[model samples]
Target: MNDSFKKIAKTIKKSNSIALFTHISPDMDALGSSMSLYYAIKSLGKKVSIFVKDNITETQATLVDTNVFEKDCNQSEYDLFISTDTPSQKRLGDYAKIFIAGQRKIVLDHHLNDDLKGDLNFVDTSYSSCSEISYQVIKELKVKITPQIASYVFMGLSSDTNAFTNSNTNASSFKTAYELTLADADITNINELLYKTHTTKEIDLKKFLYNNYHLENGICFCLVTCNDLKKLNATKADCDFFSSELINMQGANFAFSIIESTPSFYEISLRSKHGYNVRDVAEKFGGGGHICAAGAKLKYESIEKLKDTLVDTIKYSGE
Candidate 1:
């Protein structure tokens, strides 16, 4: 094992109680790595808890035990704190203070951002997902890949890679998937739940997105207002993956979806095709993610003003 991996493994082994965390708006990759490591450490007889500030969407919760996540962390201290799929402590939301309070902290991530807040950082941008990195860490810990752990890891890998269609996918990712399948992970079931299954409300929102999206200067953008969501009876979960879908539009180098989750509060999801880097766009708004896919949350006075600002930002950035 490499020095970084070895250091992380040694730290985990020495710790008696471990706390795990991810970013604010936790995605499948974040949840997958955190929960998979939770099982691994628990199997080793270590006390473990996952602190998640955000409520997991119903679709993502199906991949693993939702009970594993706690809204609040009660412990005054932990032996070790590990963050997965989170670039910085700021993204940890309310749990940032908890992570800082730990005796030792480690960050396992795949983002290109180097502003790591962990005492021990194991970050590899080449890795397809944080789940893949966690797989390596668990292997070094000598933890057996149980079916349950394998399933969670597989869920993370599939979702973050967009079913292995994103640019980040590589031979290593497929090899890891193969091993997880050998461990009896239910790949078929994961695929159906993540990709195939969607509620009626989700389908209608997608239709609305396609019909109403604005296209200009190689950018395709759409907005889902709070009123629109209320009329369709859709939650934020129904809007997931909409930005990724927009990136598939013909001749569009960049695509974005702005969701008004609450009044004047917007969640922006950005995607890029043809080697464009959406992470730069997101970073400009104080968000950071992968090169092709990134996001940010903002609050504006009005949706019209938000759209105008976003269009100008995207146009100028793309040029």
Candidate 2:
């Protein structure tokens, strides 16, 4: 349970400079909630900075400002570091070193099996998205949610819940959305860019996944290697919805998508529902998330080897 709000608030109140961070290859929930907290904290007259090693993917550019994150962080300038939506230091990617170097750290996450033992922590898996937890943090800080801040929280909530259609969605998700709307959240931008719109490249990737998905033993899975992406002129970001789409298969109990981020490095996203547990599979690969959704990134020597390892691991895990 998240039982340390007073301690977290006290830490923030004492710190003069702050640095904000999130997981590598941040999804909407990761960036949105972190940046919202950045703005809220800055409003309190504290110097705040955001440090991220990766660029915002093309699909994410629709909702996030690319300029909002910096490639480098000077650790000496910040008195405290805050991480959002990230479950572990390994998930921090290149930023893990800087995060480890921080004298004081705070983690606010909703993912299960967390390993980031911050000086201050607030982790609650009961929430559908980290944004909901962030909303509570803002409230505890007594900061009013402005339109911009509400937009971030709302985007994080909507994206993480897949427009409130995922199994994780609960009454609190809608209630938070309602309150954000009253705060003038930019629903139009979120609805249009995140849900309504798609690029030609994304559509092409969708067609590719549709044609290539494998169904065996109630599991439907698909993957795109560097060669596949090169042939399609698509990037990994365009494959964001592949797992979500595969989960729609009528007979499948589990769906997964593996996208090669670079060379032999792969990024995998898993989805499931109706009592199935994909998080268990992800943890086997040193990653974790909600019961119905999870992810992992790994590097392999070859596509064939990667496929073999994944198949064997999933089989061993009884996935």
Candidate 3:
């Protein structure tokens, strides 16, 4: 086993109780990886629990059953805490305290920019998802990855890669999927849970963007005002994948979506064409992700000023 993988396996082997966690506002990738890791450890006859900063949207809740293990934030007595898909400690949200206070911890993540603060860290920026990392760790430990594990990890990779369309996917990802399929993973059922369950509200939100969003300088941008969100009856999760659609727009160099999370706060999402790096843009505004996909949050007094600032930044940077 590799040094990093050994470190994690050793930690798991020594611990009696394991508490698994993911980033705030858990997406499929984050949730899948955490849950899959939880199950893997539990199959080893260890006590395990999974916790999230907030409840996942109903759409995601239906897809993955978090009830498989006990769920809560009280980790004062837990033996090991595992943080998945979180690039930094700050992104842990309310659970930051538990992560800091926990005596033993491990972090499995795929973000390019990670300020990992863990006793054992397994980070691979090149990998498509943290679920992929979970797979590797389990394989190195010589544990059997069952069909249920495969389905969850596949959901993680498929969701993060937009079903393998993103640039992060590689030959290893395909081989991993194939190996998992051999283990009895039902690809059709996984896809049905992951992608085929969009709600009418989400569809209406997408239709609104299709009709009103605009593109400039080969960069497509859209704004979801608080009023628009209210009208559409959509939550932040509903619009998570909204910006990815723009990246594929013919001749577009970058795609962006800004959502008014509060009157004074805006969350921005950016996606890029082949050569561009969205992380640079996100870093400018104190956010970060991969080269092609990234995000940032801005607090402004006026929406028009925020819009102008974003447009000016993108236009002048020539990104």
Worst 10 residues of 1 by lDDT: 1-10
Per-residue accuracy of model 1 over 20-101 as CA lDDT, tens digit each: 9888878899888998999999999988999886766778877768877778786565778898998876788888887877
After TM-score superposition, the amount by which residue 235's alpha carbon in candidate 1 deviates from its true location, in angstroms, is 2.4
Show pairs that collide, candidate 3: none
TM-score of 1: 0.95
**Candidate 3 lDDT by residue in tens digits, 153-237:** 8888888888887788798888888888898876898787667766777678779889977888777888888888888887776
Which candidate order results from sorting by lDDT in descending order? 1, 2, 3
Candidate 2 deviant stretches above 4 angstroms: none
What's the distance in Å from true for residue 73, model 1?
Answer: 1.0
TM-scores of all models?
Answer: 0.95, 0.94, 0.93
Which candidate's TM-score is highest? 1
Report clash pairs, candidate 2.
Answer: none
Question: Per-residue alpha-carbon lDDT of model 2 for 28-50, expressed as tens digits?
Answer: 99988887888889888989888
RMSD in angstroms between candidate 3 and the native structure over all alpha carbons: 2.1
